[model samples]
Target: MTVCAIEMTTTAPFTIAADGSYAARLAGDGEALYAERWTLAGPEPYAVPLPLAQPEEADTELLPLADGRVLIHRRVAERHAFALLYPTGAAAGPRTGELPLGAVCAEEGGDVRVRLLPPSPDGRDAFALAVTGAGTTVWRVAGGAFGPEQVARIPGRCSGGVWLDRVGRLLALDHELDGTTKAVAVDLGRGGEVSPLLQITEASDDRLLLADPDSGLLLIRSDAPGEPRLGWGVLGSSLPVRFPECLRLGDAHPFAVQPGQALMPETSGVALRLPDGRIGLWRPADRQVFRFGAPAGWLGGTGLWSAQGRLHLPYATPEVPCGIVGMSLPPAPPPPVRLDPAPPTPTRPIPLQQAPL
Candidate 1:
């Protein structure tokens, strides 16, 4: 389905959990910003306002945890801080206020920038990337034993964070160094040991956008085909990445992939944002893009797919402050059977510029 966009610059994008149970966003009122959490696992999705005593800055980032606490990231001068906000009383009772957690600072400014990664698949721990001129530091911003802790320091300026596994131990990042960019996997469990993940070609800039832990399906964008194109690949497969001609729409990006479809990666639904401010839905097996109009006030490029194939989009209008509209996937047609002899083996993807460190 084609996703539409609205000019809602004041509000921040919703940070949803991997399981689609909860989400957090920064809602603005005139010049002030406040944190809000949405509970989606219940009968009906609803939001809880989480305004602190003072208004939050526009750059503050928020991520919701499965336990119902919202992790907040803010910059105080040069130090980027981390904290958790939760209601003091029980969820059913009146919300006393937000309880701030300890902060993790990464002197951010000038040539350095720090931001939270996507919600961890485990939904218990949270992480952030501190990108500096020399390297990127991955910090456990929340859910650590003692507040925030430095987990790994990866050499090179990295961007784009995707958890390759369910436990969040293996992280895939697009590392740009010496004028080339390629996706590399960081083994957080092993002192952030880095390894090649996506190396389409020596010159190609390969980036991993989204991955499905259940199916090992990876949504990738790379310029290996002379031009940047969206493609799909298996996590550990040796097959050369297949750049589908149907996914060549300029500037389009995939944001969400269907989960719980273990071993059926090709059937999982993929959501992408078209260049002209529309959302595109496609499946690898079908190899065709489905167009649909985006809801008014829909958060562009941010959504969650249910295990049952429902795509839930979070949107907010002036009348309805927080809302989610789900789009049901159209039944896919059967694939054509092959009558000719089996094809030759596909090409193996090229290795990274350097060996794993």
Candidate 2:
């Protein structure tokens, strides 16, 4: 029997870059769906519509890059087409530009599924995962010297794409094999070298939820404690993973980690969804979880954390078709020093390894 993957379905109106610089989304004008890009790193955020002569399909996925280009993935029958969307001159002038990258056609069985991965940490490249019964293929859809290149293929079904390092080389994916799922690190630079990243237990299902490259912090979910619970760990730290009681809240899921805290991982803010649909904020230094009301027309469970502890949530309403609500968090106190280090548990993650392509 087949099992469902632990990946979160992309339903947000906008998909933001890992650097919080730009966003891409499909906007609807009552009848047709069109792609729109949002600029967030400026003094004031603004949206640019990249509508073509033809409307974009409802199922098309968009991922924004650091260079202001939006990568679009559209499925035409069994063939998956990729392209780059950029704004042209005036609307009265030439139409918005779309550079067709290439396409990936699925096998005949209709069992293959393809989707764009999250924005890469480097912000210059975009990737997609095509899952088939044989294996999962990673495709470099955008920001490639040659358009749409097949970079790596990993055995077994893999889900969840979390970049472990800042340069976008090490990727952590939850690999499902032999009815067991564990989070493994895929060295994209080494042609998808697989290594064990999260081995909480032999039988428990472990999935990586979120990662912060700046701080080397990782948010994880695992059933090692008899049931699935959210936990925290450092990328290469010798410390065993810790599942805080405050993180076990019902229906809560971590979405973003505050960046630019390389020396203080515990001080980094974590943005999560509360059980009541509101936004919840927490930090490892502070064991308490604070709840904030989500903005009206908020894209559910989607947001980004700034280095200074501000949460930027994207929302669209009649009044504000494209808007981002910024929430400033109170400063967190420094972490308390523990003279006696915690004992290492058996659930520590294994070090990453690389293999030839």
Candidate 3:
């Protein structure tokens, strides 16, 4: 069945909060720009258009913070700038920052470790790597400051890293010299020491994409043959649970892994599109599969997640223009009620006399 569309003039990447609220980047024609916050249960989401300082020339990314705030990262000039949006009424200006090793990267697990680098300056770009557990530079920006940290060089370039918990432990995907990839868990608080977990292949350029790290499970993508496949592995386990089939890479870009499922409110897991064009949710503990119908005209270029116990799917439906769709599962049936016969009542009632009479 077709669902209602959440209208948007222009939509960018969004992060779903634990409460099912969302903060997304909304871009309209002209320099009209801002981050909008929406909740599925509310009548309408709150849209806060950014103040028109100078027109932003490029797109931006909205990263949700743990404190109910958001970090807006906009790429300007040759470097990236960031802004902190407070839950109250304060907004920090765009701050200049540098990426480690001069590569395009993303923060994993809140602000745990960074992963992936854009094309290298010398033209040999590394797709995967992470800050080693023994590596002291695991944190360059501390106390809520934005900056790059230097560290000892490791054997392979890191394609992705994920923080498994709030304690700073991380799982990273390393692209080894022999073209294969391996998953390693590094204790960022300790020195950058590597603990071997799973080895996918032995080629130097094998790409390992870290998706979401929740509790102790890590969602990863193996792109050795250029076709992406989803895999789930634990921190110390050698065998990885590979999804039966490959997943659609969607415009050749990495799909963000949302930590929890909105539809299945009782469980926690990762959701993504499989190669067969089906959006699948895999619960890491039991590997239970939850499949949803892909809306018509969705070229796999959509974002899928459960927010506020409702499914938030943003896709291009053929019947309608591009927009975000929110869906909630039907509530469970009420217990069967037992009917009882009504008791008979007197046909008429006697009237009372006044004491004065």
* Best prediction by lDDT: 2
Ranking by lDDT: 2, 1, 3
**Once model 1 is optimally superposed onto the true structure by TM-score, how far is the C-alpha of residue 83 displaced, in angstroms?**
1.1
Which residue pairs collide, candidate 1? 1-292, 2-279, 2-291, 2-292, 3-279, 4-294
lDDT of 2 at 266: 83
lDDT of 2 by residue, 90-190 (tens): 65775588899998887676567899988898899999999998899998888789887888898999999887777777778899999999999888888
Write one digit per residue (lDDT tens) for candidate 1, span 215-262. 777888888777787888766454456777789898988989988887
In angstroms, the error of model 2 at 226 is: 1.0
**How high is the CA lDDT of each candidate model?**
0.78, 0.79, 0.41
User: Each model's TM-score, in the order given?
Assistant: 0.88, 0.89, 0.54
TM-score of predicted structure 1: 0.88
Superposed by TM-score, candidate 3 places the C-alpha of residue 228 at a distance from the truth, in angstroms, of 5.2
Name model 2 segments beyond 4 Å from true: 1-12, 91-93, 108-110, 338-357
Q: C-alpha displacement of 262 in model 3, angstroms?
A: 17
